[model samples]
Target: MTRTAQVVVIGGGQAGLAAGYHLRRQGVDFVILDAQTTPGGAWQHTWDSLRLFSPAAYSSLPGRLMPPQTGETYPDAQHVVEYLADYEKRYELPLQRGIRVEAIHRDGPLLRVQTDSGAWHARAVISATGNWSRPFLPAVPGRSVFTGRQLHTVDYRCPADFAGQHVIVVGGGNSAAQIATDLTLDDHVNVTWVTQRPPHFLPDDIDGRALFDVATARRRALDAGRDDTGGVASLGDIVALPPVRKARDAGLLQASPMFDRMDRDGVVWADGTRAEADAVIWCTGFRPALSHLAPLQLRGTRGHIATEGTRAIGEPRLHLLGYGDWTGPASATLIGVGRPARDAARQITALFADN
Candidate 1:
């Protein structure tokens, strides 16, 4: 069966929810399709110790502010899940959960979203599928032959699972740092953290709110053709989360240079030393989850679709929201996505007017 609307949104996560709120306000007929069976999207899969980089109020969707969590400077994953569920209910966004979008194809004057259940055609499509589904691990030598257990960010759950094991965490980003901190509490666990370079910890006072402001400033600078200032690239690699602070103060959070290669049961450094590890966790990051859009043949270098604002450069009717800075400054964050989402919805409305 083929259903139709003015817009079809892919990936009903934070990005999709933000766009849905704006599209509703714009009075456009739209539906958001989510692959997950429940609310919270990727938040549902994060490690048990995961916490927001920002305060609840600073991390919110467009239409609603996140309620403050009791005694929490950074809300936990479940709290975020509850907030997203409530946000969905409050807005009454036309979201269809448990529906996986297979591909999006051109259908005459419209675009067709082929899903496992059925098909939906729309005048425009918003691809908000964030990259959690596509975790990335760099090709370290002997990775395939490494005898130790290997896990990526997608497969990691809790540090308790690694208790008493020599765990090697690879990456300098927030996940590697936080997970390392969490692992420090596990009895008899030895964590060997390796990063390409020393981790850059943000100022103790600079939180997610500060970063969002920086992103806003950078966006405005780009708009004026001025030198870009204070984008995420200019900031530290890790936020000073409470656990991270405790671990760092205790001297448990320092990192060594990345290993040159992985051998059976461990990693080897360029200095001809080796550390035996029972497990290796790759907090290496992710690529955009855009396999469904492959049918469009629109991605260029960097495996991302080029964009003018939120609209795809090659397909005006498609808006690729919340991928990263290229789509919009900090659009990947809950707070930063609002401005770009508003722009995308407004552009979609204008496209209809032009038609």
Candidate 2:
């Protein structure tokens, strides 16, 4: 027998939990399908030194605030994981852990969410699957033939393993800056930063909270049908955190333009100069995790489904959350996800209420 629900949330991360909070308030019968065995989602696997760009007060979900870290202004990965576990217990949300969803198919007017353990028939489906699982690496020539170690940000753990080795870090985002800075702390490790373009850094005073406010303003302007090109900064740009600033002061933030191709043991620059490196770390970011929705054929060329707010334009029964700004402004962040998730829940409730 197939278990059914009024809604099925296909993730248990911040976005999923935010949706659950609003869904519970609406009294919707929903079940959150989490791929992991534990409460924390991707936070459980982040690098040890990773820290949130915002303080605990600014980084939080819908219902509860994240507890302030002792002696640390920004919460680290472990703290986030513990908070998520606590949040799950406090709310008593219906979350089915370890159920990796394999596929989602339309069954009549409902969605058949197939998981490894079982299937759920849902009147509406909310996909909050963020991008941590799908890391993207640029296809450099001779990359396959390079015999050195190559890893994406998702696979990176600590810089201890890279001691006494020459490492090349790629990308121009927050992860690239943080990882590159972390690797520089060990004087034995020689680090080189590469980017497609000059990296943009937000001023030291601008933190995640400021970025979120800018995004909110832009979203409000757009909603009011006004032009919003106010020269505000984007969250994707690097933030001048204390460690990153220290690395810059130490001259470790020097970035080289992306090399032309990879050689046998290293990368070759456009000027025919080759830098011998032992490892290449790609912090090139990620794409949305929507493989389970392949059967729906709703994706565009950019691997994203067209959406009006959180609701899928072509498939009304489906809603997407926390993918990126395309779904909602700053939807990928802890504080920014709640607004979109709440809107999605309201829409879903209204959709079923009319029936």
Candidate 3:
């Protein structure tokens, strides 16, 4: 079935929900299309022990403040999922779940969004699909030849699964640090943490709240034509959460240099040093989930759709949100998405006004 709307939002995750909230506030007729069977989006698939870097209230959407999670400073994955579901319901946003957008093609003046359930032709399309679906695994040599179990951060659930195993955790990001620390808690499990470069830990006091403020300040400085070398990225990659700090204090978070290649039973470094491992967890990160927009042929040499702010430079009717700082300062986070979402909604509304 082919449906019609003024706007169709792809991806009903935090970013999509934020865009929907602002579109609703702008009094525009729009509907959100989500690939998830449920409302939580990627949060539903995150590790069980994963927690936000900021407190519940500090990390919220545009309209509602996330309710405080009892007995916790930073909310866990399940808490975030609940909040997302509640946020969607609270706003009464028009949403259709379990609809995977396949491709978006230009249909005369409208953008035709083809999905598994049906198609939506809209005046504007907001592609808010976040990157969780495409977990990045670095192409280290002999990865396929290794006999050991290999998994990305997305596949990791709990330490119980790796009990009595020597596990190698790779990456310099927060996910690697937290997962490495969690593995150390299991006495039967041995964890060998490695990173391509030395791990950069953010200040203990710096959390999501501080990160958001820093990003906002950076954006403002840039907007005023000032060179501000300060943002969440400048601080550090790893957030020194409780789990990470505890592991650091206990000397359990020591990281070795990344291995050059893997053999059948173990990994080898350039200097000929080697370590045996039963499993390897790659927490490399992710690419943007923008494959559905391939038909538009917007990706540049860098595998990204160039945009002037959130609006596509190639297609005026297309807007990309929640991918990263390129769209807007910290737009990928729950707290930061509001700025770009609100901006996109207003821009699309003004475009309609002009029409």
Candidate 4:
């Protein structure tokens, strides 16, 4: 017999935890099915040195306060995992670990999600599996001929692994910057950064105000549709305190121009300049791995689901959290999942009433 849940959440990270929390609060029967062996989705795979850019105060789950931090820069990956574990315990969330969901399609009136373990039937399903599942890497002309080790930033574990090697870190996001900095400080590896957009680096704190205030402004710009054209980078225009400004000006670290082409020996820049590297780390980010949920009529470009605010296009019952640009504040971070979860709870309550 196929077991059924009132609601089924597809991923068990902070987003899934948030959904589970609200479902429990609303007295709804739901189950969270995660592919991994435990909670804290991508955090489990993060390098040991990784730390949340957002402070502990901003990184707490809904209804549960994170343990106080000693300093300011935020806790490491392990801390995040511990906090998530604590949240699940508090809410008594129905989480089934190591249950990899393969496909989800609509069945008559309910959505059916099939997994390696079993099948789950639900009126609605929320995909909290973040964008990190599919790492984006561009085909740099002649990649096959590159006579060097090439790996995405997601595959990287520690700086000690690349010790004494000439490395090229691609992309300009915080991940790339942090990895490059780590390698520079620890491994003494030669590093060259390649990026399409220059990142707007900010201090963890500014005049005692949280860094999220600046992040909120950027989110507003994105929500307003001013960022539609892929125009000039807005990150540079945002004002920051002296430390961040000094870092950018000093070129201690900054973004490089976009990539152009590549050959077996080295990578070529957009300006026709070539740089040699023994290894290349592409920090190009990721995409939604929704191959598992092919049956839902998802409105999206490429493989990503398109959502209007907290609503998942026509699938109102299916809310997406930890997805960039879906909701207010910082929807992509663990701290941002709560607001969407609350909205989802309201939507689910309305759905139950309609049924």
lDDT of 1: 0.91
Q: Estimate each model's TM-score.
A: 0.98, 0.97, 0.98, 0.87
Q: How close is candidate 2 to the true structure, as a TM-score?
A: 0.97
Q: Which pairs of residues clash in candidate 4, taking residues 3 or more apart in a chain or in different chains?
A: none
Write candidate 2's Cα lDDT for 100-163 as tens digits. 9999999998999999988999999999999999999888899999999999999889898898
Q: What's the alpha carbon RMSD for model 2? A: 1.3
* True lDDT of residue 246, candidate 2: 92
What's the lDDT for all of these models?
0.91, 0.92, 0.93, 0.74
Task: Please list the residue runs of candidate 2 whose C-alpha ends up more than 4 Å from where it truly belongs after superposition.
Answer: 230-236
Per-residue lDDT for 1-355 in model 4, tens only?
6999889998998888988888888988889998889767788788776767556776787898778656645578888888888888878888999988888877888888899988989988888888677888887787778998998877998877877887888877667777766665563677777677666554433421243454556666777776543322333322333433444465655556766877888888767898887998998888766677677768566655667666678677676777765454566677767877887877887888998
Per-prediction tally of clashes? 0, 0, 0, 0
Residues 1-355, candidate 1: write the lDDT tens digits.
8999999999889999999999999999999999999999899999999999999989999979999999898999999999999999999989998999999999899999999999999999999999999999898899999987999987888877887789999899999999888887676788989999989998888889999888889988999999968686588889988889989988889899999998987999998899999999999999999999999999898676888989999999999999888888889999999999999999999999999
Which is the leading candidate under lDDT?
Answer: 3
Candidate 3 displacement at residue 284 in angstroms = 0.0
lDDT, candidate 1, residue 169? 91
lDDT score at residue 23, model 3, on the 0-100 scale: 97
Candidate order by TM-score, highest to lowest?
A: 3, 1, 2, 4
The candidate, 3 or 4, that scores higher on TM-score is 3
**Window of ten residues with lowest summed lDDT in model 1:** 228-237
